[model samples]
Every structure is written in structure tokens, then in C-alpha cells.
Target: MTIDIRPDDLTSPEMAELIAVHAQTMLASSPPESCHFLPIDGLRQPSVSVWSMWEDGALIGCGALKELGNGGGEIKSMHTRAHLRGRGLGRLMLDHILSVAKARGYTDLWLETGSMDAFIPARRLYESYGFSYSGPFGEYAEDPNSVFMHLHF
Candidate 1:
């Protein structure tokens, strides 16, 4: 399948619905009290650029890049649709996002993923892309549910 990925308008109706679905999925995988899903409006901020991936005209996944200032960025809200998992789409999305970050002159890329079983795949993916475990960054602590990682680009 020819998957088309592009920068998206965060306020677009389709993108908004996609964000809602992603947030809901995050909540489903984690408890309400521990969930760190960012609301749609928070993701639509000026420093963040959201992107949507489509396969055969259907939304397959989405991700966002948040400028962390001083040549750094944080990857946020990366999710592939339920039906499209394990087809290497996740890797494709990761590669695209990292490329975008590099293109934007970001020298440091950091991310926060849950440390639960549900996040095992994410940790593996990040590791495959040279992201190593590090102390928690941003507003996170050393919680059992949070894994902190970073990659120097």
C-alpha cells in the first residue's frame, strides 16, 4: 500500500478526530490516573507540528513534533491505527518523524513512553532507532509507568 504522510493542520476536522482517537487509545491502555494523554488543544500549540499518515485514502496513523528549544524536540502522540499494526507502519512513521526533526535542524530528539507492557513495542522501536534509556525529561519523574529516552541527531 502506498502510505502518504504529510504535515497536517492540527485544527482540521479529520486531524482532530484522529487526535481524539489516539488520546482515547492511550487512556484505554493506561489507567485514568496515570494517563498523560495530551488534549487536542494542547497538541495544537504553535510549537508543535502534527502530521497525518494515510494509506489508500484512510487515516492510518499520526504523530507530532514539539520544538523543545535550543535545537531539541520531543516526539508526541505517535499512534498507528488498530488495524494497521505489525505491517512495518510504525517503523515508517518513526523514520519519517526523525527525518523531519533532522531536516528542521533539531540536534536532540527525546521522547517519553510508558514502561508498561503496552509500551514494549514503542521502547523497542525507539531503541532500534538509537534512542537510549535516560533519566526522565520534561514533566516526568522516574515513575514505574514512564520510560525516558533520548537520541542525539
Candidate 2:
């Protein structure tokens, strides 16, 4: 697929709606009270950067990077539209996210993902990208449902 990945304003109408839909879907499919979906407005804070992926004019996926200061970064809200799952779109997204993290002089990249059967694939993907299991970072406290992973770039 001819995909184009670029940074986008989190407040863009299209992206805002897309993120809402993605968050709703994620929460709906999640357990009783999982807080897995990061809110769009929250991600629009000055320290964060968001990106949307497009393939031949169709939306493919979106991901965000947050500068955690001290040259550390975090990955937030990585999602591929349901219709376009598989076909290497995820690899593309990860590659782009990682490259962006590196360009910002981030020495470490970390992420928090749910630890559920639905998250197995995501865990696998992060491992494939060399992200290893680590203790929670940022505001997260250890939870049986949360898996923290990080990479030292």
C-alpha cells in the first residue's frame, strides 16, 4: 500500500472525530472499567505530538508521541482502523513512531498498554520493535491490567 504518515494537529476535526470513535471502540471492547483509551484533548498538551496515517486518501491509523522531558518519550494512542488491519500497516506505524521519537533526541521510549487477551498482539508488536517490559512510568501505578514497556534508543 502507498501510505503517507505525517504529524497532525490533535484538534483537527477529522482526527478528533476519528480519535473519539477509536476510543469508544476500545473502551467498549475492553473489560468492565478499563481506562485504556487516552483522550484526544489530553494528548494535545504541549509536550505531545500526534500523527495520522493515510493510505491512498483513506485513513489507515494514528499514533502519538509525548516528550516526557529529559530526552524521554512515550507512545500514546496507536491505532489502525478496523477495516485496514494486518497488511503491515502496524509495522509502518511503529517504524514512523520510533523514528519520530529518535528525531526528537529521546533517549528512551516507553508505553503503557492493557494486559489483556485483546492486547496480546500489541505486546508482541512492541517486543518485535525491541521494547522490553519495564515498571510503570509517568502517572501510572502498577496494575494487573497494565503492561509497561520501554526501549533505550
Candidate 3:
């Protein structure tokens, strides 16, 4: 299958709907306070670069990398369409993110995801990429509902 991942301006109707679904899904799976998925406006920041992944022109996944200063970066808003979860789309997007981070000279990458069983797959995915458990970083604070991970390049 052919896959394409590229920078997205987050203006298309497809992206808007996908982002809405992503936020709603996160809120439904985790408490509002525990869900840290950024809103569209948040992802549009100057420091953040978002990418959309498509397979033969169909949007299947999307992810973002936010420059956190000092050669550090944060992975944010990673989501693959629900029905397409096991098809390696998430891994594709993740590999793209890591590649971009490394190419940009980022020394560290971090992410925060749900600690609930619903997120086990996600945690495992990150772990498989060499991300290790870590305490909260940047503006994040410790929370039982959140699991933070860090990867050093």
C-alpha cells in the first residue's frame, strides 16, 4: 500500500472532522482533566508542526511535533482512524515524527498519554520505539491518569 505523510495546515473539512473525532474519542476514554489532546487552535501554534497521513488519498492518521525549546520536542495529537488502527498507520506517523525530530536536531522527545487500560496499546507502541517511562516534563505535572515517556536521540 502507498502511504503519504506531509505537513498539514489543518484547514480542510476532513482534517476538522478527524480532529473533532480525535478530541471526542480522547474525552470519552479519559477524564477531561486527564485528557491532554490539544484543540485545533492549540495545534496551530508557531512552534507546532502537524502532519497528515494518507493512504491512496484517504486520510488515515495524523500527528504533530511541537518544539519545546532547548533541542527538545513533544509529540502531540497522534491519532489514527478508529477502524484503521492495526494497519501500521500509527507506526508510520510515529516514525515520521521521530525522523523529523532527529533531523531538526532535537536531543529529546516526550509525550503524555492516558494511563488507563484503554491506552495500553499506545503505551506499548511508544515503548517499542525506545521511549522509556519518565516523570512529567515541561509544563506537565504528575498525574495518576497520565503516563509520560521520553526518548533521547
Candidate 4:
């Protein structure tokens, strides 16, 4: 598949569907209190940069990077369409976000994901990219259901 990853406007209809599906999937995997997904409005904030991956005019996946200032950035809203899972679409979107963060001069990248079985693949993917387990960063406090990871350059 020819996947094109590019910055996207969160208000677009395609993006709305992608984000909704992502939110639903996350909520299904973890309790509402433990899910930290950012809604579309939050992704549209000035500090966040969202991207959508498209192939043959279909939205395959999406991811976002939120600037935390002080040379730190956080990954948010990463999701691959249900039908496209296991096709490496998630990894592609992640690599795109990492490159963008580096281009923007971010010295570190951090992310929070669930500790449930449903999130194992995601944690593995991050680990493959050199992210190591880390303490809660930014505004996050310790949570039993949450796993925080970070990569420093």
C-alpha cells in the first residue's frame, strides 16, 4: 500500500471518523478513568500537531504530537484503523511523528499507554523504537493501569 502521511486538520470529516473510532477502541480496552485519549478538540490545540495517513484516498491511520515545551514532546491520539491493524500502519505513523518531533527540535518524546493485554503491541512498538519505561511525565500522576515511556535524543 502506498501510505501518505501528512499534517491534517482535526475538524475534517475523515479525521472526525478516525478520532472517534480511536476513542471508542481505547475506551473499550481500558476503563474510562484510565484512558488518556485526547478528543478531537484537544488535538486541535495550538501545541498539538496531528497527522493522518491515507492510501488510495482511504484514511488508514492517524497520530499526533503535542509540544510540551522545554524541548519535550508527547505522542497522542495514535491509532490505526481496525481493518488495517498488524499491517505496520501504526509503526509508519509512529515513525512519522518521531521524525516530525525531531525536526521541530524536540530533545525528548514521551507517551502514555495502557498496561492491559490490549496495549502490549503498542508498548512493544514503542520499545522497538528505543523508548524505555519512564515515570509519569508532564501533568500525569502515577496510575496502576498506565505505562509511561520516553525516548531522549
The best candidate in terms of TM-score: 3
What's the TM-score of each model vs. the native? 0.93, 0.92, 0.98, 0.97
Predicted structure with the largest lDDT when compared to the true one: 3
Q: In angstroms, give how far residue 94 of model 3 lies from its true place.
A: 0.6
TM-score of 3: 0.98
Q: Residue 52 deviation, candidate 3, in Å?
A: 0.3
Model 2 agreement with the true structure over 33-146: per-residue lDDT tens digits: 556567887887888888899988877789888888888998988888877777777888899988888887889999988887887888999999899999989888888878
Q: Taking the tens digit of each residue's C-alpha lDDT, what string does model 3 give over 44-133?
A: 999999999998889888999999999999999999999999988899999999999989999999999999998999999999999999
Residue 113 shift from truth in candidate 1, angstroms: 0.7
For model 2, the superposed segments whose C-alpha errors exceed 4 Å read: 31-33
lDDT of each: 0.86, 0.84, 0.94, 0.93
lDDT of 2 at 75: 90
As for candidate 3, its clashing pairs are none
Q: Count clashing residue pairs in model 2.
A: 0
Ranking by lDDT: 3, 4, 1, 2
Clashing pairs in 2: none
Give candidate 3's whole-model lDDT.
Answer: 0.94
Q: Which 10-residue window in model 3 sums to the lowest lDDT?
A: 53-62
